[model samples]
Target chain A: MTTTLDMTALDLRQVNTRLQAAARAQANEDYVITNPRGSHAMACGLDGPLGVTIKGSTGYYCAGMNKEATITVEGSAGPGVAENMMSGTVTIHGDASQYAGATGHGGLLNIKGNASSRCGISMKGIDIVVHGNIGHMSAFMAQKGNLVVLGDAGDALGDSIYEARLFVRGSVKSLGADCIEKEMRPEHLETLAALLDKAGADARPEEFRRYGSARKLYNFNIDHADEY
Target chain B: MCGIVGLFLKKDDLRPRLGDMLTDMLITMTDRGPDSAGIAIYGDAEAGRTKITVQSEDPARAFADLDAAVSEALGQPVTLTVVDTHAVLIVPDDRVAEATALLEDRGLRVMGSGASMEIYKEVGLPRDVAARFGLRQMGGSHGIGHTRMATESAVTTMGAHPFSTAPDQCLVHNGSLSNHNQMRRRLAKKGVFTRSENDTEVGAAYISSRIAEGASLGEALDGTIRDLDGFFTFVMGTRTGFGVVRDPIACKPAVMAETDDYVAFASEYRAFADLPGIEAARVWEPEPATVYFWER
Candidate 1:
């Protein structure tokens, strides 16, 4: 059965408590939330395979630390959406503000519109796909993840990146230190194709340029001290 | 962090509710900034008259003979209305400068002076400050507010936001300016004087000086992106319009909504949720280094 929660009448704590109780019960139910109206920390810290659909925009830290729930925002989201998420899927129908999907461990975060600055900072393991432009300093200090952008990237894309793979279809303003454009081989194309398919994006795989760490700053080599 | 809000009504039907709506929006952002709060309201202007809003530590003693003294000094009729620690002095338009100087010499610090605008600010919670000023009961065509957390300055009444250094112009900022000291000196050279040590006042003076030099509001905001350093999201009010601009980095959060009746800006979306017909408004984030202004 599907449950409906109207945030206009219910407080955020009560809604989160209900979601947590439902997760503990392992109920195979879906939830529909309406009239969110920019309340922060909605549907956060869930660890079940439930389905949730929010009808309107949300504020900071929405759907954070998710384990196995699928959450969808019908409108835009504020900062830190799906932050530190693990093993789930979060989709935004509209734009996302700064620090979207920051430091997620394992999950799929898809944004249909543009994402603001620091899209995936300090991400351990997550797959982020954006259909529109991303702002400056995205993927900063990202350890392990896959970031795919169909539109242009702002300044300082993937600065101080490590292990994470980045793909951009449009021009990059500038690359961060130790982050460089790598040769897009057939395997990389296959990986990009899979990511695009999972994100339900229409862009072709071959149109993207791959980027990753150059391993020059991995171990603090004395030979590269001058560049530092 | 700080919270900034502005409302410019395009329809006459919503003018009476301007203060009520702006008070609700400012209170919603109490979590972002809880140290101090301020607001500037642009009421209807009367012909051949101008107003100066001043704040004093002791309103009872400072405003007792203010109207009589200023009227005698300027040789014209003057009126003073006291609201808590703030008082508005209405005088003849021709003697506005002389009246302002007289009030300052009598130890009253002018908050704002214009044909339409009046400013009130204090060091307290936004809800308390709004209540103290009876903001919900006042009426205006356009207004702007700020809730400050005391990042770069002390938590004092003079340090609160809605900094106005020019007539009919005031600015509220949500971020810091890295080069305000140097910029303050530059504006001083150009004959724009700033009162407080607050960086936001410098920003206001910069824009006012630029406008004095024949640059439009949009052009002055564009100049800020080139000359000013650091993160900022500024919402300013003039006699007829409201303008918003963000820095090139855009580290500060800002959201705007526009409908048939009004144009509103806030630090987040919660401030717009309770407005009339907000569900149908076109809500969006202002782009970096771009100016958005609305005039009636």
Candidate 2:
């Protein structure tokens, strides 16, 4: 069974209890948390097929630790929204605060406007798509997964960039360690297009650029000794 | 503890008085290391011949020793002129090691070392260090710098990082050593000279010595992944570009920011805040026992 909670009469605590109760009753049940103004931690840590729809703005840590649920935020969200989320779809109509979807393990995060710094910081398997400009240090030492930025990137775009696919459509002020601009091949173009589509952005994939490691500094050389 | 700053020619086109950038950056970080400063301004590669700047506690005596050592090692009667606390030596690329070893062997403090090729560092802060060294006058394509909060080892020029860990390799470390003593003993057996008691020096030595034995920088880094005992975040720059790694389990903090202006990684995000436009900045923490590699 699906449960709809009108957050106008209920606080985040009640909404959470209802979502948990719904999860206990039906594993596949979805919860729609509605409120005109954004609140904080509206729907978090819900597991199974529990879908969450927040109709307005929300405070920090909304949809955190989520598993398998599809969460949609009608308006903006505060810091650490969807942080360390396991598996789910978190869609935000407006912008997000710092550390959005940080250290996420899996699932997809779609930010419509833009995200602040430490967005998807230390992401593992999750795929994040930012339609607008992103803040500084987008992906520092990210181990795996893909981050698609449709707009210009901030300073230190991928400082000490790891094995993550970073695609930026607009100007990239600077690039991080081992990150170099590469020729966008047909295969890469297709991949970026899909990411944009998933993020609901209007940008064409060709407008962006691809960056990764050059692999030259991976090894040391005496002939290149003077080079360091 | 000290702060370091340098400016590499990010722009492809050559400009006049490029050393001024290093001077500017070094000035910004002067409060980080104020004891003594040095700079070695490198010329364009096509121009040929690398200029080296070095500093020492015993200024006049160190220069004399450096001059005699260079003459003896190269057998070419090299000229060493003392400019304040620094001694300027212009030489070809390959001769750097024999020259450095000879200088160190003769008891020269060797505060900061560099060439038209790359800059090497030891303990000191930014501004006065830059003014004393005059870095804003050189030019190059790529550069790497460091800021240190020294722990466990005596803070001195030698204890400072960006050590010439190998022939042309230099490294900066941010962590404590758990098994520094053992590692030092192991490297010593292989004829790698152990300079200071600092664990980071061992790491630099390990990387350089491994590369000297034909190991790739990445492979050497991976090699140390198993052998070295510590929680650390480290960055090393070679003529090749830049390379960084974190311990399998993070024992320290490191952040990377990429923007339209430049890609910068530091121990804190407060470092990259002012850049103009960017999609976003993200911070990540390495998992326990995870390794990452980046080259430029």
Candidate 3:
């Protein structure tokens, strides 16, 4: 069975509480929200196997600190759509604003349209897949994650990256410090294929070029101190 | 962060609703900026005549017999219309310099002087300021509004946005500039004087000086990305056109929507929710470091 909540009538607190109660009781039922109208902090801090769908656009921090629950946004989203998520899936049907998924530890965030700057800054084991272009300085200081961009990336893509992999099917304007192009071997192709399958994206794995950390700035060497 | 709203009507039928739509768009971002508010309206232009909009804290004394005084000083007839703290003084186009000098000598602060553009601004919530100026009643072909949160300058009426540095030219800015002081000194050497400590004033002055030097609006905006150092989103209005540009880094947020009847810009998408024909309008974020302009 599915539960429906109208945000126009019930406040955010009540809706969040209902979702939390369902999560606490281990309920597997699906939930649908209506009339979001750019409201922030929807379906946040969830730790359940249930599914949640938002019918309209949302404001800042729409789904921060999520775990296990599957969340989907039917319309566009404001800044920080899925910051610091820990598992499960979150998807956006339309465009997303700046800092879409900053500093997340786990889970997959898929955006169907364009995403603004800093799409995955300071990430720790999160997979972000975008069907369209991403803005500048994306994946800055990222650690242990995979980012897939199907369209062109803005200036300074993957600045100062650490142990993270970036795959782009389109042209890159510029690469940031300590980030450089790498060879896409068969293993990377298999990994990207699995990720694309999991996200239900329709891109070919062979079309992407890989980029990663250069390992030149990992240690404080006197010869490389000037580059800092 | 600050909020900026601009509406440029392509069709003549939408001119009467310009102010009402602009006000609604500006007030939607009250939470983004609540310290002060301002607006610039470009109404119909009259041949061989221009108007100067001035604001005074002591309107009762400053505006007393002001029309006769200016008329006598310029040796020509002048018309004055007061709306709360603001008053528009109309004079012959040739006497604009003489009239502005006279008003400055009389200790009056000139907000903006041009044939078509009239600027109004103060330190307060946007809703209150809009009400005081009867924003909904005013009509024009195009207009721009700003709700400011003072981060780089003192909170005074002079520090408010929609800074007009040259005749019929105005600019509103969101985000800070890193090299304004250097640019201000450079522009000062080139005979462009800025009136306020606000960095946005320096940007306005830069554009005005460029246009005065015979550079097109697009050329001036292209120069901004090269010369101006910082994260900024600028919405500039001229007598006959409207322009928008963002910095190379594009740290600031800006969205634009266009329809057959008009073009609109705001800091976010929510500002366009109530606009007429918005559901059918083509909306997208303005590209970083690109200039978007439209003219009548």
Candidate 4:
């Protein structure tokens, strides 16, 4: 069943309360939200297998901390969209602001348009795909996950990164302290192809390059402490 | 956090609704900032006249017969229009220096002076401030409004945003400056003084001083990128246009939307949701360290 939720007629608390209540019920329903009006924290903290679609743009922290619910924004998203998602898929049809996906344990964040600064920071196991450009300091200190960018990246991509796999199809302005471009093997290309297919991106996997940590900063040595 | 809103109209028909549009945009951001509110409007500039906006703690006594007194003292006709606790005094353009000194002698705080710009601000909610000044009824070509949360200064009337330090120029800030004290001392040595201890006032004075030294608006904004340290998203209004710039880190959020009829800047897209034809506007986040300006 598809449920329609209108924001103009209800306050922010009431709107979130109904969504949260439905998520707890695990009804496997589809919810449609209209007149989002760039509100913050819409469709956040869902832990069920529901499908949620926001008709318009949203403000900060949209679809944050989701477990199994799939949420989609038809318009642009504000700062920190899909932050710290445990699992599920969050897709933004338009542009996203700063820190598009930060510190997520698991999930797939697909951005169709550009993402501003710090697109993905400190992700534990999240999979992020950006069809457009990402700003500076993306994938900073990333521990584990796959970040794929099909467009140009701004300054300091993957600063002080670790274990996470980064695939970029375009030019990188600069690399961070411990980040370097590693040769893409067949297994990496296979992973990129699968991610691209899942995100419905039009680019080919072989067109991209990969970046990851140099593994020097994993163990902190006093002599090299400045780099850490 | 603070909220800033700016509108620069490309079409002449939208000029008359400038204040109404800006007031709606400012009020939508009330949740972001509730400590103080201010708005700067660029209205029609009468030939050979400079409008000085002054604020008085006690308007009844301070503004009573003040225009007559200034006219008698300066031997020139001065017209005063009082609204709430603020008043705009129209004086001959050539006598602005003499008139400012005379008004200061009587203890009236001069908010700003320019050919077309008139500023109104107070230490209250944005909604209340707009109503107190009847901002919706006014009209203008371009304007900037600020709803401040008071991070680096006290919540006084003088400590509000939209700080105007130069003629026909005003600025609204959304972030704090780390090197304002040092910059203040540097500008002071060059005879550019700030009236408030607020950090944003120092930023306003810095830009004004640079412009006074013959730097273009774009050059002055670029100077902020090179010189000022800390987070900031500033929207400045001039006689003919407005400019926007953000710090390199861009920790403070800024969203801009442009249509054929107008260009708008807000701290959040929520502020732009109510604007006319916003769905078709080209909305995007401004890149860090980039300067964007629109001139008539």
Candidate 5:
């Protein structure tokens, strides 16, 4: 079944209530939130399985805290979309704002367009595949996640990293502490393919280089004190 | 005008003494709130479960009101016992909103609430703040704390750091907003009350109003950043850890150091330096228009 919500006239509260109701209606069913002019918080905090599609751009926290669902934004998303997510698939068709996929534990986040600064920061375990460029501080303080940047990455990528793997296709401005470029293996290429397939993007995995932790922060010793 | 902190275990296992260290660190930053103090720690009581502490001018009256309100709101008798003005409430599960709204509605500002979470201060030196708040010995996982110097507004006990802009959201600020007065006027036009003259409170209100209208913390903050003028180093803590933002060209200093082990922050690097156990911590300045957040 399909539930279409035209948000051109409804306010955010009304939209949220209606969307929540729709999400609670049918498992694995698809619902659409459409607005000729983009508004904020299109799909937030969905706890069950449902496919949500925002036909146009969204403001902030679109598809936040999703669980066992799929959400696709036809246009851009503001800050903190897919934030603190548990599991799901969220695809942003256009450019995205800062802190995308922040603190997310699990799921697949696909940004088909460029992302602003702090993309995927402090990520826990989500797999984020950005087919375009990402802004500064991408993947900063990432604990455990797989970040695939198909284009350039700005400064401080993977700062204070822990176990997260990064793959970038274009130039990198800077690398954060304990983060360094690594050689890509066949397994990594397969992982990229899996991520891209989940994101429904047509990018190839061979174009990117591998990045991971330097393991310097683990088991601190007196010799490594200066880096701190 | 508010501070907040919380901790969430990543792998179903938390670091031993991590919560306690957070408590110690939170108490260290008690200067951020000079009006009151409180802590909430989560875990084994012998180990500790999210400990929460609060300070109030009329501690007895606020406690009485909070107890009654919590009981009325939660359909259970409130029994977070206390001795003197300060007490640690074993906040019942799911009763967080009930207690918080009750305290805030009674005009008692809640600075911090989480594991070893607290908002502690009382017209005293930063060095002596812990002792004054009965935080002589306490510990918990990652939490947040704050200090305040209410300018252009009355320094009443209720007007302290960790100003709750909404239920479960609190923030602290270091610099003034040039457009707060105008923003306040506009917000008033929209039927949003100007609760206090504090710009930080207005800032929190701005975010809360957005959240109520469906703006996530990050989106509301990012969307409104350009609209807000002047300098500010806003430090916000919710049920999560600290969330920070800086103005394009503004006042206030923020130095932070992040590690896979822990992320300790302060207005100045010296505060982290002031921590008894935080040696060899990396510190740096956040870029302008930059936003940072922490989750425990």
Candidate 6:
């Protein structure tokens, strides 16, 4: 069954409580939230295979710490959207603000519009795909993940990156410290094609470049001490 | 963190509702800052008259017969309007400097002075500050407000935002400047000074100094990206309009919305949710290190 939750009538706490209860019970129901109006932290910490949809724009930290719920925002999302997710799919039909998917263990974050600065800072094991451009300092100190951007990237892409793989189809303003463009092998192409397909992106995987950590800063080197 | 909101009316029909709209936007951002709140409104200007907004700890004593004293000193008619601890004194345009000096001599803190801008700020909640100033009833072409979290300054009336270092111009900032003290000394050498120890005041002074040097609003804001250190999302107001700029890093959150009638800027999208025709307005986050301004 489909459940309609009106934010104007119910407070955020109550809405979250109901959604959490349903997810905990593994109800596997569909929820539609209306009148979000840029409130923060909505539909967070869902653990069941439930379907959730937010009708409008949301504020900071929306859909954070998701486990197994598929949440979709019909409008834009604020900073840190889908942050720290474990396993699930969180799709934003509009732009996302800063740090859209920071420090996630696992999940798929699909953004149809642009994402601002720090798009995937310190990400561990999440997969993020953006259909538009991303801002500066994206994937900073990221440990493990896959970030695919179909459009241009701002300055300092993948600074201090480790393990994580970055695929950008457009120009990068500047590569971050210890990060460089590498040849896109067949496996990388296959991975990008899968992610792009899963995210419903229309672009071909062949027209992209891969960037990753150069591993120079992995250890404390005395020779590069002056750069710090 | 601090919250900044600005509204510039593109249509005259929306001018009367500027304060009402801006008040709602500011109050909605009360959670971002609870230490102090301030607003600078660009209202009507009478010919040959200038407004000097002043604040006093003891309004009853400091404002009593104040206009009479200033009128006698300037040999002209001066009008005084008091709202809570703040008051606006209207004097002839030529005597703005003399009037400001006299007010300072009387222990009154000059918030700002301009032909059309009247700044009112206090160390209280945004709702209370707006109510005390009757912000909803006031009309303006453009206005800017700040809900301060007090990162780089004390929680005092003099330290509140919308700092107007030059006439018909004011600025509100959402982030702290890392090098304000150094900039303050540099501006002090050039005779540009600030009354409070607030870093935002130094930013305002910097912009005002640039404008004083014949820089346009866009050029002055561009200079901030080049010279000012640290993160900032500034919305500045002038006699004709307002401008917005963010640091190159843009760590500070800023959202702007525009329609046929107005252009609104805030630290978040929620502030713009209540604006008229907001659903249809073209909303977008401004690019970092870019200056965007609108003037009628």
For residues B82-135, could you state the per-residue lDDT of candidate 4 as single tens digits?
989999999999999999999999999999999999999999999999999999
lDDT of 1 at B91: 89
Give a tens-digit lDDT track for model 3, residues B2-52: 999999999988888899999998898787789999999999888999989
Better of 5 and 6 by DockQ: 6
Q: Per-model TM-score of chain A alone?
A: 0.96, 0.86, 0.97, 0.97, 0.92, 0.98
lDDT score at residue B216, model 3, on the 0-100 scale: 98
Model 2 per-residue lDDT tens digits across residues B23-54:
55444434444543333233444233444556
Docking class of predicted structure 6:
medium
Q: Give the poorly placed runs of model 3, Cα more than 4 Å off.
A: A1-25, A225-228
Which digits, one per residue and each the tens of the lDDT, describe model 4 over residues A112-223?
Answer: 9999999889989999999999999999999999999999999999898989999999999999888999999999999999999999999999999999999887876899
Whole-model lDDT, candidate 2?
Answer: 0.65
User: Candidate 1: global Cα-lDDT?
Assistant: 0.91
Better of 1 and 6 by lDDT: 6
All models, RMSD in angstroms: 2.1, 15.8, 2.1, 1.2, 21.4, 1.4
Better model by lDDT, 2 or 5? 5
Per-model DockQ: 0.66, 0.03, 0.41, 0.87, 0.01, 0.72
Per-residue alpha-carbon lDDT of model 6 for B51-142, expressed as tens digits?
Answer: 99999999999999998999899998899999899999999899999999999999999999999999999999999999988999989899
How many steric overlaps does candidate 3 have? 0
Task: Please tell me how candidate 2 rates in CAPRI terms.
Answer: incorrect
| Tens digits of per-residue lDDT for model 5, A26-92 | 4667878766233445678787788888886665578888887798988667667899888988998
- For model 1, what is the alpha-carbon lDDT of residue A117? 88
Off by over 4 Å in 5: A36-38, A224-228, B1-296
By lDDT: ranked, best first:
4, 6, 1, 3, 5, 2
Q: What pairs collide in candidate 1?
A: none
Indicate the residue-level lDDT of B121 in model 3: 96
**Candidate of highest TM-score:** 4
TM-score of each: 0.94, 0.51, 0.94, 0.98, 0.46, 0.97
**Model 1 alpha-carbon miss at residue B181, Å:** 3.2
Give per-residue CA lDDT, model 1, range B135-156, as digits (tens): 9988999999999988777998
